[model samples]
Target: MSFLVMDDGEYSFIWETLCDLQLIFHPKYSREGKIDHKELLGLNIKKVSVMLDRNLLSSLLKLTRDGYLKDEQEMRIIALLMTWMIMNNYPASAGLALKEYATKINDLIEPKRELREFNNIFDYYPSMMWLRLAEGAIDSIPVCPLPTEPFITEIKYNEDDDHLLMHIAEMLHVVYLCRRRELSPVEKMLDFLIWNYKYLLICESTLVYTAMLFTSQSGIKAPKNSGSNDIGKILVGCRNQAWDLNYLSNWSSFHYYEKTMDEIFMFATNDILLKRIFINTYTSGGVGALIEAVFSKSDSQKIFEVVNFNQRNRIKPDFGADPKIYLHQLIEQEKHRVMETISDRGNFNYH
Candidate 1:
């Protein structure tokens, strides 16, 4: 059997460039935007084809002649033409155009309503982490060449937190293009953590808190006089047990669970510190400790061993009430936990 391999980078470059060019020529080519079909038809196909592959150029010409180019279709063809120009060594103009597009994207960013409305440390901190990572990623995009001297000595957060979300979404839209053509196991794990920040930080924290709440409410006390290692095991056991219940199952969709399990297996196989971090987040130190450990560059050696246990034999809590009712109670307890922590701290705010 014969098989054909395709270059993802080249394919992405062609398609993205085509779309960019289309938008540049016909600003109204996007959906809900107006377009002049006759204007596109006037383009010199032969001259433009000099810079593009015959197949791509022919498709554009055919679409234009047939008046089938509308909405996103028109935008894509323009980007293709523009991409051909850039690949053919028109970097100067192409670079400028890209900058303009970046500016337009930046303009669309607004402060996220959730961020503004958050009244406690848990939501605020995790949301800030997401905003920071996203902004850092977007700023790292090589749309323009770097200067010899540092352009800015210190990083500053954008006033519009929503822009960070928008910019990150745009990058995710072309993640195949942004990612390295080849990735090692460590790199793959890093990408997974970065891309799925919400799952790792927010959702995982909620799961841990919920599990702890459920365990306490079920009268399942932590092992008395046990060491941190034992505490970690108990927490892990609680989490596994909670997941088996129908109520907590909603906290993680099948897709999320499968991907998380895959990563967990990978971590265990490679003896990655992430496994330690995952288990440590549920300890007495809580998610805040995990964040501190990460940011402070604390050694993972301090983390205790998290023993694996059979999920089948884990604690099965009987709430003696509707699963939905218990689920709501757990959620409210989790929220109260956050509020209590914030109340104890007093006057905490995002910097």
Candidate 2:
């Protein structure tokens, strides 16, 4: 078979591979739209290390001093992963620094484990994903596969990317909540906080962390004026860091971050997914007395399923006398379907 030609399966795998690879590419990002703020990618290890989270730098510093680590291999692996995540999520001044760092760190560490020639995903995952994405693209090149390209109206990928920015902003709100609390047994709840430091970087290998008060007592501040618009900062971070669409970077002579940030702020404040059900539950009375309805003798609780963000998606069964039946009725099949559908509605691409 010619190397240039690809099968259907091969085409499918390419997109999946790109998704996987893109997960770890750390993009250089900032709130600024100046020349320096303009994004770049494929950074070198040194520059990545410079921009790394302080805690990550500290860990590496100690590792250098101690000259040993409990699981050197795992530690090195995490560092490599961060390099990619950084490239994918943030802007890089250099190209493919993460891959280079992984190789270098792997060689430098004890029990020197060279990346296997052709087996583990970690070894050649980035290259494989890139290849697949290329095969799937119309041009069969490694450039962005975003549809709705130039000389037209706004793009679908543009909206999707914007929506994702909002999602990340909401997720950051939870992270802030976690940071506010005192350090306890971690992951005791949904937020996963319990940190002593303001912004504690805990996860080994990866530098993902949270800050108690990175800005002020109120919380994260931003260039924007609105209170709800604080999430603008988070979106700003992602925009600056994300691949291709650098926030300040001049992509095709267009610096879109300023416009994108405003759009992101609107989405974050509106919270489309939350509002969809809120409108129905509070005003329409659609979420009527759940338990009472389910328990009612006439209600068919057996067939109904509850569709709640926190609740598991499953059928709730109850006999005529069962008290929980009414609650189950509250989550009727129709409600479940609507809620499920609306839950994912914010994912719509307005592009």
Estimate, for each residue in 1-351, the C-alpha lDDT of model 1 and write its tens digit.
112122566545554543333322211221111223344335433122121212233333333333234444433443344333333322211111122223334421221211122112112122222222222321211112212332221222222222222222222211221223365322332333333342112244332332332223233232221112232332233332322221112212322454334211001001112222234433446644543344323322222111012123334444445544544444344334333433444632221
Question: What ranges in model 1 sit over 4 Å off?
Answer: 1-304, 307-313, 316-321, 342-351
Query: Which residue pairs overlap in candidate 1's backbone?
Result: 17-79, 18-79, 18-80, 19-79, 20-79, 21-78, 21-79, 22-78, 22-79
Q: State the lDDT of candidate 2 residue by residue for 1-351, as single tens digits.
A: 112334667544433443333221222231111111123333323222222221233333333334334554423433333333333343222212222233223323211111121112222234333333333332122222222222221222222232223223333433334333353312212232222111221221111111112212132222121122233343343322222111111221122253333211100001222222222222222333322232333331321232132134223333247433432343232233323332354432211
Error of 1 at 264 (Å): 21
TM-score of 1: 0.21
- lDDT agreement with native, every candidate: 0.29, 0.27
Q: What is the TM-score of each candidate against the true structure?
A: 0.21, 0.20
| lDDT for predicted candidate 2 compared with the true structure | 0.27
